[model samples]
Target: MANYKETAKEVVKLTGGKGNITNAWHCVTRLRFNLKDKNIPDLEKIKKVPGVMGAQFSGDQFQVIIGNTVVDVFEEVEELLGGTGTGEASSNEKEGIISKLMDGISGVFTPIIPALAGTGLLKGFLALAVLTGILDTTSGLYQILNNLSDSVFYFMPFFLAVSSARKFKTSEYLALAVAGTMMYPTFLDIAKTAFMDPSVVNMTIFEVIPIPYVNYSNSVIPIIFSVILLKHVHKWVRSWMPKSLSLMFTPMITLVIVIPVALTVLGPIGSYAGEYVGKGMTWLFDTIGPLGGVVLGATFPLLVMTGMHYSLVPIAFSNRAVLGYENMIGPVNGCTNIAQAGAAFGVAVRTKNKEMRQVAISSGISALLGITEPAMYGVNVKLKRPFYYSLAGGAIAAGAAIFFNCRSFGGGGMPGLMSLPAYVHVEDSMNVVWMAVCLAIAFFSTFILTITLGFQEDAAEEVIAEAAEKKAIKNGTKHRVFAPISGKLQLLSSVNDNTFASELVGKGIAIQPDNGEVVAPISGVVSVLPDTQHAIGIVGDDGVEILVHIGIDTVKLNGEHFDFKVNKGDHIEKGQLLGTFDFEGIIAAGLDPITMVVVTNSSDFVEIMNANDEGIIFKEEELLIVL
Candidate 1:
């Protein structure tokens, strides 16, 4: 995690420093910059930044792809920018309307997606509860659960307003006020009455202008369009009004002028636009039927690649708002995700490179859970054939889903196997079941296709060494890490702490020490030996930065029940004494005694392989190989 912060610093420096960036934002997998001088930063140098997966100038923006840790990096960059003397970045480079629209949509939607996805999953679980007969819908707990899930969709306008306001550079509180008006009880109560009563008609404001009963709940486009207008209006009002009056009267006048227009004109325009788009999609699918799904399904990966997939987000939201469910972009997108996951899984099984296999398997799991960027970029796109096979798999899966009446009734933003429960329809209980069948079809079809249709593999998995172990650590000489003091060897993923388990610190093995004894795993200088005596770091002759930590959160013990023989900068030999800790004391202190040995500079190597020690391991045994 700290490595990504350093990555942020490197990225900020590489991208013409803090001053060069005018506007910056992030999507799921990338940090996008609107630079004052886009040409100043070299793409190659940007790509070489430690945490960056890739870098490119996409259309009118400079994009630095950073998987998973993009948010953390974005925050760090923001903090760095704030610490210095700065002004807003201004850019003169012109962009097309389409590019600008895409940027706007991405900026506005990116911040709110996590909320949507989280609540969406909750909604899915609630559906499962209903289906399993575990809870009656009429029960108090179910009632609370239903509204808890509904809150986000019902207040979507507020979320959109905050994000859109920031994108448009307007007052946040005023934007909230506008959202408040849209969801006001006065209007919502009337709209509900109109739905039930036959004689109710459109209400006239000042007995002159008629305002349509547009349900603001679950609405998106209206608030976005409204905020765009608000940006201009706020500026205009501030320019004309007294600066002293601006603190109060300006908002009053702005709301007075904007709310009426929103209800009477802009609201209806956005409302109709969303309705027509929903209707248009319905018509297209109905006329050509399953063929329409085939085209969209096959092209979903390309959409993800070019970052144009976000363009479909609003349409999907709109469809859910207007038509109560969307057949496109939700369940169909999940099928494609499953297909991509399957393709990555196939690559994982086929590739001889351990590193590539690790990446493929992890990315494939992420795809199955609903995020596909890692799988798509790290594995399938690189292999080429897996990507193509995925398209076919997605097409067939989507066609099957549509044919079986699977649709996204919940409108969850993250689509995958986990979200299949969102397809459940009370009137048609088979909806989720059909979607599961389709996703399974996606996985098996693409997996089989990839294996049967093989592609060219990487040139080599193991690095070829030129020289011997006496040379510099950079040389690709075979390196071994012996057991420091082992009991049962466990994968790092099993560690309770995220900092270690996520491999944010580094990658290696965790061990449950049979006794208190600790020894050096490698012959090297003791690079870091903390006073707390819970951890030690060594730099191996093979250029591996090794760290051995005793137990989880043992640092909080403040040197309790610990002793060490080594000091920082002391030269240590392989299997030599380093330290000892009371594992029984640590356990009694309510802490985990799982010791860890990690290669801190793992990315510097071609591959790191385990020496195959599983259970009840002894001391001074070969544990890991570094190449």
Candidate 2:
């Protein structure tokens, strides 16, 4: 993997230097850049660069997809930019209502994904063990497995503490301290005593009291609230403590003060608030009856897409608290998954593209198995029709569930076949029938809708044909290499950004300029000319697209001192003067001009060879190895 510094330097060079960069941030797997000039960087070149999955511009943000390793990449990029390693940007821009809501939901859930997946796998294994009679419920093995399953639920506070701290940019230790207070042994003892005899303790510290030794194991709200309090307490203590002693006294004093406040006031308040929120959701369903289910089911898929499904988790936990079973959410989640599977099935049946069909089938199966990212991102997002079909199916299932008065009887978050026992209401024979009906509705609605609205053969065939043609072109030929710039030679891999320096995109060498003039690297036709004149793309005779981007974030300068030397679609030769840049002027304007030559059609070559070493290079010097 490319280190962070290398990635940032490359991005800086690609963007036309620091002057063109407005702001940068990252989310999950993408580096998002906001540029002053919309077009200074050569995006095609960046895309072809190694370590880059793709580049996309959406919602006024230029997003560079770096896959799962984006965080490390972002860290390196930040160091190169002379900023703190924190991934967040200091921007006052207010997000839209929808965006804010989505952010809030993601904030709450993203951190917990690993824990959830791990615990879920453990539970699945336990079920398998019992089903296969590997261990009796009374055996030590069964006991150990049960403890493992229960540990995750009990220590959720510790898990949330870490995730929330990262999200809030607070001291992780402080967050842990707060969680510890909530789950403290002393406090639990006091609570237990109080619950056993409420009248014995008259002088409450904060006009509130603990529920005397009630086990808060598997609790969520108390930890969340305590951490929120910890944020303020940590800030206060850090600010007040003397610099020399801060490393120790700050956390110690903060914990002392915050723990009491949490135990006496925040804990009870948070617990009650969570209870109310859950009750409110149940109340809404009760009042609206089947319509509520219909509405939630219909829109749940959209909520998931926008990453808002997490807001409903509190409700599920609350359901378990109040009724000893998770009723409203698990069934709905199962139905939603079914709906996604339905959509993928639809796409598979409709598309003629072999790749698309294969992706759809695989994603659809994953969705059915309760993992939906692949289907959602790779299929539904690409083809909009399947998404709507799934939504319709979900709505139908929700309606059927509500009409049947189906309710869960167990504590699982999302109900699957194993959780069917949870929804059984012993007194009502109709409960079983209702559960069966809801399941049938969810399954059949998705299956039938998808099959009926499946793919169109013509569209699939066209896509497949285009893919084949591209593949053939990639394999059929080799092309002449070009010198990206006229300067003293530097290895492309030595330029600092591993993505380019590693020649991940294609074989090319970097240049340390003896002077500041850029020439055409190859004999080719100009393809694109950005507005800022910071970048240019040329197609060589060998069918290779080479892109040259100047500096990092120079697009922010809005073409202030940049001068273009050619027009798009113009034919040019190697060593031809393509453009001239005022290196001093660009620096004075606060930009970095580290030019990069990239093969946009990198897949076409079987290999890229770097053929140059240290020396002054005229425009026509053979600087890259391409096979």
Candidate 3:
């Protein structure tokens, strides 16, 4: 992995800096920015960042593809820029109703996905253990594991409340209060008692009004409705309340009025709405037979691409709560996800273009893990033909799902193999068997179709030439890398750090410093200079990325005895002073004083080899040869 902090800094700078970012957020695989002016940012520079996968404009949002490490990079970017962007992006200008609604729901749910996915996996594993008799259901370990798995879902309303508050730009504490009240022990007890004995429920609140007793556990829609209502109501109250007493009375009055209203009106309304949606889905499936599945499966990606997919999220949750299983979502989702992977794999196999092939293969693997945006945007949709192949595959697999009556036993963030246990019906083993079959069919059908129908052909030579030009190097291209410090040259393997010794950070040679000064190894732009000042990243004009580490684990010194002479993005020629470090101080701190000069982008070249005999070397001497 690349240093995420460095990547974050570069991304922010490339996107017109912190000043230009009006708002920023991230999803599973991309950093999304709402810029003051999109044209001011150099999108090309953002795309060229070492770890970045791709960049594009999606509607009003400028998206940077950072693969799976987006969340970490997002946090670092936020910290580096001291934050830019507001959560009030819901009021985006001229956005369609569906687009805004989808954006809002996605914004609310995206942050919650990690917890949901983690617990979902644990839940699935627990179920498997019990089913296979590896874990006794009555055992203490089982009880502990079961609660660990179920805690997230059981208190889902609380999580949703917090996330929805941000989406609506409301007080998170107030939203959480609503959720807490709904799930309070007193409320849960009353609701449960009422369900067991309907006569005990107080049907008449004031002898004329009717109120329903309902448990809000594992529910989604009610809290969202309540919080959104709270935002507007809280604002109205604040507008009229006395300024001196506003803080005290505002929350008091808002809670007193909003809690009852939400329980009596909004909460029930959401439940009824959920019931109707569940009924509508059932009616569609029942009335149209397998045709409904085929249509939904085939059209799922289009819905996702248009940002309309979030509309189905609540329905899936509602189905699990009301029907104990979701027939409308899980089965088709499995097929669609697998189909996306298969289509991308097909592209990888059929495309002669090296870049496209690499992207397709990598994104295809991500799709299989339930993250499909990379595959969908980076490969299938880009190629056009592969997307159609995926749709065809999804349709066929979903038909099989309908025939088998496949369903999900629970609801969570994303649907794929990780959530397969959600489809397992203990009473009917066929559910698991058929779900697996559906995935297999989707993968194979899409793969075969994409291979057969192939993408529109580009001139083979032209495709190869384009890739070569982008890399800025041919098979025989050579570049010289000079020693960045006067030191004893040594094999990279002789370094104490495994990251350097194993060549995972990249192919490189190491040096035992005789002095403290480090210089530029080649004429290049400084790409990254981290805060600790222990390492520097230089992007050579020849496209090689060189990293010079001052000493092993010297970052722990916290710049105590080190000083960097150059800042990020500065241009420097070979032998120019880049930094000075304390070699003896590092040894006194019990750290290895070995310096590493690595070709971080060595894979882009045909060969990168040590040029000098391992011994004393001076700055400006030939150190490495790249071809």
Task: Per model, state how many residue pairs clash.
Answer: 1, 31, 2
Tens digits of per-residue lDDT for model 1, 1-627: 358779988888988887887767787678877777776776766777887878877666678888877888888888877732244446666778988887788878887887887778788788888888987899999999888888888899999999898777787888998999999988888887877885788999989899988778888889998898888888899999998778888888888889999999998798789888888887888888888778889998888777788888888888888777878778789999999999999998888788889999999998998888788888898777899999999999988877775778774657897887788766778888888999999999999998888766543223211112333656466888998996999988888987788786677888998899998899877766655888988877555778999999899999998999877656678989887889999999999999998998787777878787467777889888888
How accurate locally is residue 7 in candidate 1, as Cα lDDT from 0 to 100?
Answer: 90
Candidate 1 Cα errors over 4 Å, as ranges: 83-89, 196-199, 460-627
Candidate with more favorable, higher TM-score: 1 or 3: 1
| lDDT per residue as tens, model 3, 410-489 | 54646777778766655776777788889999999999999998976333335334333566587888889999888899
Could you tell me the TM-score of candidate 2? 0.60
Model 3 per-residue lDDT at 293: 88
Q: List the candidates' TM-scores in order.
A: 0.72, 0.60, 0.69
Supply candidate 2's per-residue lDDT for 239. Answer: 82
